[model samples]
Target: MQFDAILKQKDEIIQQLQSQINPLKNLVEQLLAEVKLLREQNAALLELIKEKDKRIQKLELVEHQYHQLTKLVYGRSSEKTSTALPGQLSLGIDAELVEACNINDGQKIESYTKIKSEKKKHPGRNEIPAHLERKYIDIHPENLPADARTLRYNRNRTIGI
Candidate 1:
């Protein structure tokens, strides 16, 4: 009877542990499912970001190409070219119209005279205006000797006069 009681007590303890372990196992399985779902969503989002980055790079490349093309088309011209051959003119008119107006190789064209200008010749001295007042001054020195004689004076005008 004593051995039976010991065996029964061990069986009851094992039953209680089994009952507790079943609910814990179910909780662990549920948590593992949630983790797997989160990982899948994260991977999908990463793939979407990679695709968007590749598209952005392609758009940037296209924009750069367009910019280069516009610069080539609309930018300032170099205007550099080989010199044209002598007597080989480009009249820009139609060939038929040019042929109709072409001059003969041996015929001489009429010449035109250009008007020319000539500098005016210097006129001789101008007469003084009759309205100007004339004043004369005697330049005789006060300290001259008693025998000093008078001489003809020069007739000159100052700018103020």
Candidate 2:
């Protein structure tokens, strides 16, 4: 009879544990479904962000091309040459203006030119300095009548004299 009572208490403990396990299992399934929905929403937001970035890049490229075209149309370049001479107005070569104004044959157009003469100036030789004076030394040979006579004078003796 005690063995039978012990078996009945064990059966009650197992039933309580199974009742708690059923509620925990339901909570786990609900959490898993919520996680799946959030992942789908995150992927859609990432795709939207990528599309916006592509549109911003395209607009920036178009803006850069517009600025380049504006600079090309308005910037100064060496290709444009002036056609007006001196004493005449600096009018650019516009087809409409050139066609409207024609040179009259009876109009008196007078121009004068002056001749220029260049004078050449020669720089003369430099003069000697006032502080420096010239000293003339008379070198008379002692043996004057030899066919080819050579003289060896000491520099110290000449400088002292």
Candidate 3:
């Protein structure tokens, strides 16, 4: 009878322990799920941070390029030259004198005219020609002294509609 009672008490104790263990097991499972979710969120946040960093780097690069472009447009337009070495002759010319000279000189010169070529019909669709006026714009270099002369002047022609 004592053995039977001991067995019964031991069985009751085991049942109580199992009941406590069931709740603890469930709690452990819940904690594990929370930890997994937190890990995933951390990974996603890290990826987002990395992408933001890349975007920031790109924006910085673009800003740097914009500053360089601004400098090119509004800054000095002349090329920098080193100091002339000994025995080197200066090739700069007086541009003001060149500009003062008149090419026409109020004199009539003989003109030689060329014969006009015959117009050839194109094989494609007849496209009417839009006779647009020509526009001329003179661009001068910056930072040149009034007495200084440019080595060469460029002539550009653009047609306007």
Candidate 4:
């Protein structure tokens, strides 16, 4: 009777161990499958990095070609040459207009010019008007009727020092 009881206890313990072993094996298999999936993702990421490198190289080559073309088309010299002379307009000057004109003491001409230049460098979203486009040439003394007469008289009166 004592030998039979000992044999029964040993058999019950073996059965319990077998039941736990199967679940542990299943957990190890799941972990192995996850590791394989992670390896595949790492391989795909490496491939993507290589493709991005190739694209960057191609863009750099394109930029180099564009610079070469620009240099070839535009000469290195700063001076611009034209075959024909620019058209000139002759206006009769009146000395009386210069005698009557009054000069402004508070004119901020320099600041106005700087502001306009800055605007050109960083233009607004709206398109520029034709009047503003012509402002640079328009402000010249030669373009103003009264100022042109005064400048012409002064230019002719001044002797070479």
In order, what is each prediction's RMSD in angstroms? 26.7, 26.7, 30.7, 27.4
Q: Model 1 over residues 13-88: C-alpha lDDT tens digits?
A: 9999999998999999999999999999999999999889767866777897687667667765552232244788
Better of 3 and 4 by TM-score: 3
Q: Which regions of candidate 1 fall more than 4 Å away from where they truly are?
A: 1-13, 78-161
Q: Tell me each candidate's TM-score.
A: 0.39, 0.41, 0.43, 0.39
- Once all C-alphas are superposed, what RMSD does model 4 give against the true structure? 27.4
TM-score pick, better of 1 and 3: 3
Candidate 3 residues 1-161, lDDT tens each?
99999999999999999889989999999999999999999999999998897678667778977877677667775511233558899987554464457988868979999999999977888655678665656676899889875654345434332
Residue pairs in candidate 4 whose N, alpha carbon or C atoms collide under 3 angstroms: none
Tell me the whole-model lDDT of each prediction, alpha carbons only. 0.77, 0.74, 0.76, 0.67
Give stretches of model 4 more than 4 Å off.
1-13, 75-161
Worst 10 residues of 3 by lDDT: 152-161
Q: Model 4, 84-110: lDDT tens per residue?
A: 236754454444454345676446655
Please give the lDDT score at residue 125 for candidate 4: 94
lDDT agreement of model 2 with the native: 0.74
